[model samples]
Target: MEQRHPEKRNDRNTDLTSDQNLKDRPERQESDKAEQDPGERNAIDSNPGERKPAEPNAGERGSRERNRGERQPTERTSGERQSVERASGERNPGERNPGERNPGERNSGNRQGNDRNQRDKDRNEGVADRHEPVDRVAPDRMAGEIAREGRRSADNGSSERQDRSAGERGPADRGTADRGTADRGTADRLVVGITLGDYNGIGPEVILKALQHNRMQRICTPVIYGSMRILNRYRNILNLKDWNLNGIQNISQASHKLTNVITCWNDQNHEIQPGKVTTEAGQAAFACLQRAVEDLKAGKLDALITAPINKQNIQSEEFTFPGHTEYLAHEFGVQDNLMFMVSETLRVGVVTGHIPLGRVRSSVTRERIVEKLNLMYQSLKLDFGIQKPKIALLGLNPHAGEEGLLGQEENEIIKPLIKDLREQGRLVYGPYPADGFFGTRSYRDFDGVLAMYHDQGLIPFKAIAFDEGVNFTAGLPIVRTSPDHGTAYDIAGKNQADETSMIQALYMACDVARRRKEHQDLEANALNPKQVVEK
Candidate 1:
């Protein structure tokens, strides 16, 4: 866990100008006199008539006498000497000194000084009370300590309260405390498999950047399915020479403390032509994906986060699918799956994905839409922990077919399906114009949106959340997610690719995997209400 630093407060110079400080420390007054402008001091001595004829208190008189002893006395007439003695309270005061401040002014100045000193003292004490040790500590322990201190400061609370609060809320709040409990829990963190996408592209760059976070290891152990040599090439290019990865040939040798890399290939002299599409790069990408998927399917891994891959170059005799989603769907033997785009605020799943724009019209069937909807619904409940999810469907044509005049798909196909689903008690609505839906930001009204085609959903989703979106295959039995981007041949190896989407994909994969396990546990442990009542 990343540690937080407490802000340091500078309070050593407090109360320097307070009246008590000036009276008790004559040296401070002497320093003030020494710091005064020499011309101003000379002017005061040269024109005694301009000096304030204030009657000095005994303390002030003693300070002045000591300061005056360091310099020659100014020549004055006998009358002026008597007046000065009278101002110094040596004689009866028949008349008040002209330069003496009134009692109200003295009292106000003293009050202002005292108020400022009190405020500074209070601020310093508050900072001291809130200050934590600067050294590194576990985040959960730190959070607990902070909470305890806060409660104690709130009302002289007992240690019992602190202990109880920490016990009740510490794990839930920090998430670090709960990593030690059960299977894939505390004893062993969830091992997430990350397949390095096209080596020539920005995959290794982003993977390295995302894994550099300190919190990544605390939550789960990451195993990179690629050659360490390839990773080192990009690591050197990115100038992350200081960053290290634990290289191992198999998962058995993976380390929990460091990022583990499995050498999927043995080739050391493979040419790495970055920013260019090459068959070798595609083959290498496929090799990494195949190895990672094998581990994932064999239950050796908890989740899989695939980096961006080039759809065209990755095609081979063994891998003929258009993209990772289709390939994973086939590998897992799922006949149909939803290509879902996920972000913090919006979720969109296309009814027809990776198909030509011409084929999209024919693919917009009621069954396909219903299939994607069910997948999205289950994903929301089991993977996202949402109890009831509302879904919106985008129209195939302009103005939602304008009452069947512009197009018949929305009126003949989409509207009927939505009506049937609503009758079946599903929170489904739409056949809405895609333009107006996103233009008016109506997607915010629903939990998810079902687009009729690829661009209908992605064009807007990417525009809104390009940096943080994750493309998740919704119906897969195993968790699979990837950054919502492709191999940017233009910017590959430039070290300018943003890693936000990759990090988000990793986070979503782990979160969904954990949620699925929790859901399965709940289903397995579900109690029979009637049997319980009889007992």
Candidate 2:
């Protein structure tokens, strides 16, 4: 009996030198038995000196393992054992498994199956994980997966668990949450109310036309207070079949994405004679105005834009006031309000609004002029974002009363008011003659013009900006604007009327509302001058 090298046992014709080696080294014998296949082990034990079958090469053994779908025990080095373990789906602790693909590897069908299985597991756990890095997931797919997971949790009645999961979400999920918050915030555009004035006139026509612009929908949510039946008729008459309105019963149901119409009257049988000023039209107009004003007062509306309404036709027991401006002032409990006419180039306010020519002389007092000027000044600063407003005062008489020759109202009342105002550190100029002031385009030199009467201011305003003028009521607690025109019975249903004024009025209302909010914010957060001095 003799010792033999273990490496020499793999030779095709080698024989064990002796059985004494196996007896002497029991541990080596057991190791060899464990490492060798059963057939080889049996052959070696049967006859120690017998020649064993030639050992298969590494490639052949691997091919045989694949064909048999099982691993065959064979003597191998440490590195070779690791390779075999990896091929057999076994690994050391913390070592990556064979199923995991490297970055450069092509995605095979098996990898896809593994990914799907992982996703299914995540869903069962009520988690929205892709088992991949956040950057590797497409943004849209990530959002969709999160939404699906949320819905699944809701379906399972696991709202509490859903909330907990949201709290535990990573940065990508938090980003999605922030985007959702921003989408909701974007729906907070100014809610503007448009009152369909004098339905028998051009009110409905211009309203439909104004709302057709896509920009209107982007800037504000328009709620029309009128009869939807009449609006639809006008829409069809104007050949605007493509336009649509979301009809809701109440202002709360108004949609931010569509132009909403709230039906104020249910007079389905009422005939809409576009050019006629009938009692029914007046009553219907009042109904719409009343409902709109109710909502305006309740703070549901951010701003209001009224279309043209016939003054004589709209007058009733319920609406006894002269016009929208006066009615809004009385409703808001304000004694003094100015009729502020606004355009891109000129801004005018009347000292004596809706008064007769004879009363204009009486109403053009020093106190009244000062009140209107103060209102215009404040409106310019707050609504128009003008800090130091320069205003021009139009005279009550011709040539500013020619120094008391033509009329003494201007020389006595208006001149004295202007001088006193200038003394008090206010930018108040002239008692300029109304005719020459506008004829020379002097209105452009000032921030606002104070007229002695309504027609005096509005006549020139409409003449200059007939298509774009906005009539804003100054000194009120709320923002209100309207087209600087009346209900045009001449072109009521013809569809020939211009909608520019109505569009500009709506724009001005939203602009003024935003400016007022900004002003209020600045006032609220303003630093105290006295505190600064003390510091």
Candidate 3:
């Protein structure tokens, strides 16, 4: 599981000047009302016994007439004056008591002020409580300003919402979330065959690390195809002797609750040297892979997850392909297969694999591109359960040929093919520039990406998803996936190799197997609608 980082709050102070302006209207006169001391009112009552009612002086009478004349009767209606008085928390001019206010009117200004203060408090405390209804009594201008402010707040606080929801749902719900709710055929456990590649490299180490416990058995019965002697040699070096290596003679004898191992060859006289690729080590790796492939072909295994292999040393008359993808394609008699890389978040396929850069341009023909696209389109719908997959096609030249100035592949080949595919009801798009497409993360909006060459796709895919990338061979009769990496000869026995990618490859094999079965069942039932198929 990937660890989530904490969300950084927008600690910058909010600028509420517009809202403050509305609260300080001239008619309300909050300053004057606040300045009037309560001491003056108490003083008037304290001397009631000695006080005498006096006639108005000439200055006071003149001042009263001037105050009354300032308000034209039509302009300053009694209702408007009362409204202002209620907002300012002041008694009417003719009221008998200093603390008295109109019975029908309350201090709306004071109530609004309290609400604003509470909102500020909640914001500073990092709380977004939507239960409090918005203040409708506030003026239209103030309400508009507040609504915009709320939107800004929501945007700033949206980063960790998914994490927060997961937290609320608790661990059980998180486990279910990890296992998606897609209608993935039957839930039966698959028998996944694991091939040990280049025992001298990090292959054995990662295999041990990936299947250390019985958790994987819940999904599939893993059968490791390699020499038990070689596995023990690496196990002793890495101090993993406590892990079980349940030995089995064949796939049928494998145990579901243990890490089953099937020794494909005897290693009594073989040498064990870490971080070194030799003919003996390569031969042993080939022996294990050949046995596993044979078993898989005979229906003894549901899927195959191959570890990393050294291409040069593994070359022989029996296995004479560039890499695993090519070798598997040949073994299955497949003419066209896609080198599709799958991760939790992204899926990428290349038009050319294990070929020279000089030949990339020539290899990227319309027929070949369409062939890879058809394989990917079917893989997405059947192997991945996506109904209508959207695919992004990358250009052969830089900046997608720049309108034929840099290259003409995009204009002549890619664009025309895309138009044809779309007309045929396939949701394919673009000969987009490779750098901009991956750099801007536009790939996330689509289901898959088809790069024109090996380095163009694998370079970025490994850089971004090296820890969990699974190389799957699409359009093959059988399912085969391997970690998207070669034998790390340098870090072979250092006990430092990360097993994340191998683990992901195993899980991906199981998922793809289940999806393929489900898809086949659906197709069969569709063809024979009158006959019901058993799960």
Candidate 4:
């Protein structure tokens, strides 16, 4: 306001000066013609001081005023100025009219519209950022994040909100809308095949006991792949009538509906007694596993969870595979097979399996070690839901050779592998001695450990997680997992075995199945972005 006064006053003063300056025009005819108007002549005669001030440039002053009035002001009236700005903003879009709209209203309306559009644009941008993929993320952890987000959004207190809604409906008569968009589909019916490891062991007993709980029905439609007679025999021995087991020939027989009962797949036709280790029992267990793998290959079963299998028993004249994991690896034609033994606290991945102890040092290579580390990382991601997994490496020597004082395996080979992996931006550590490191509290600092051989890892792993360890096969095209402990023939049919590991294997299998599906979906989306579009 203060700055505007000088401009207004200057215009007034210039007008006065211009009038007086017109008194001394070079064109006497034009000057006298102006004086002929009585009002102009009287004003000029009365204001002699003003006339004297402008007498030097009368014609120039009159012409300059006429030109100045032709141009538009950079800023107009307080109200028209706003119009000029808004109109200038929109004015360049096309032509303009002198009287198209009232200046004040047009400015305010346009400003309001611009503000609203900017706010909406910002809001939409914020929402668009929520769906972008976090690169290199683990599959299970991504699922957990999705589930937690869903649960968080469902807990919006809509029930309490309806209490104060004051609608026509009574407050006490509100339906249960509390669980909006919750984990209903997440806890849906997933079909998983549980293959009894070996009939001579606790495989049959654990399968029967694990199905006794009704809560398992809520998570998945579990199917026992062994004989019906074997399953019922264990059920009879346990004396539990809560089997709730449905006999199905294939996936078609089992209901694909949600919240369904457990389905038992009767694949074999052999009658075997408990505490017996015969060739017939071995063949029956093998056939059950075969059927289960066939279904898995055909996409009928999401994943296969083996209870336990004895390597020696599976080594009949007809059957000659080391264990369930190796046999499945061979069946699936898997080359990059990694055996991951998992406890609640620690997980161990074996670089080489079932080889002689003498060959352990030679089997550890830079490429093989690197591949094992990569598999362990991916397995921890998909199977266990671990994000940013940290892996520890165990040396082949006694004390990691005290820097090759006892053996040069760590210094010659393992150290180079560690350097390359670190350079590749992977989180990996150690090459500590096998026994010394596994026996200490340092195992807690890692997500998985790479052991040189089988017993080097299994000894401490089983000591810590005796009954709860689960063996997970990594880098397979499909999800394959099993119980960590072997088939126990001593306690077979005795009903003295525990089913905790078997139950964990089933849960882990289901989780891996979901993860595999999710990973496939992500890959599909990445390959064809047009398949997914926002509304």
The best candidate in terms of TM-score: 1
Model 2: CA > 4 A from native: 1-184, 527-535
Candidate 3's C-alpha runs over 4 A off are 1-187, 524-535
TM-score of each: 0.68, 0.66, 0.64, 0.62
What is each predicted model's overall lDDT from 0 to 1?
0.73, 0.72, 0.72, 0.64
Worst 10 residues of 2 by lDDT: 12-21
Query: Which scores greater on lDDT, model 1 or model 3?
Result: 1
Q: Candidate 3 at 526: error in angstroms? A: 4.4
Worst 10 residues of 4 by lDDT: 128-137
For residues 1-535, write the lDDT of model 1, one tens digit per residue: 2322211101111221232224445675676677588754554345445545674333333334333333224434223434555576654222324344322344455545765554345333422111111111233232224323432433323422332343334334434543333234334466899999998888888899887522255456789999898888887788876446888888878766568899887657686788999988888899999999899889999999998888889899999999898899889999999999999899999999998898988888888888889999999988887899999998999899999899899889999999998999999998899999999999999999999999999999999999999999998899999999888878888989998898788778867876777678788999977668752
What tens digits encode model 3's per-residue C-alpha lDDT throughout 274-368?
A: 89989888888899989998998898889999998889899888888888888888788889899999987889999999988888888989999
What lDDT tens digits, residue by residue, belong to model 2 across residues 131-219?
Answer: 11221212222222432342343232353334344435676866665565435434546788999999889999888887762225435
**Backbone clashes counted, model 3:** 0
| True-structure lDDT of candidate 1 | 0.73
Residue-level lDDT tens digits of model 4 in 222-336: 6777766666667777775442455556655764221122224343555556666776666667777877888888977777788776566667664577777777878889877
Query: Which candidate do you rate higher for lDDT, 3 or 4?
Result: 3
RMSD of every candidate to native, in Å, equals 16.6, 20.2, 19.8, 23.6
Which scores higher on TM-score, 2 or 4?
2
Better of 2 and 3 by TM-score: 2
- Candidate 2 achieves a global lDDT of 0.72
- Model 2 pairs in collision: none
TM-score of 1: 0.68
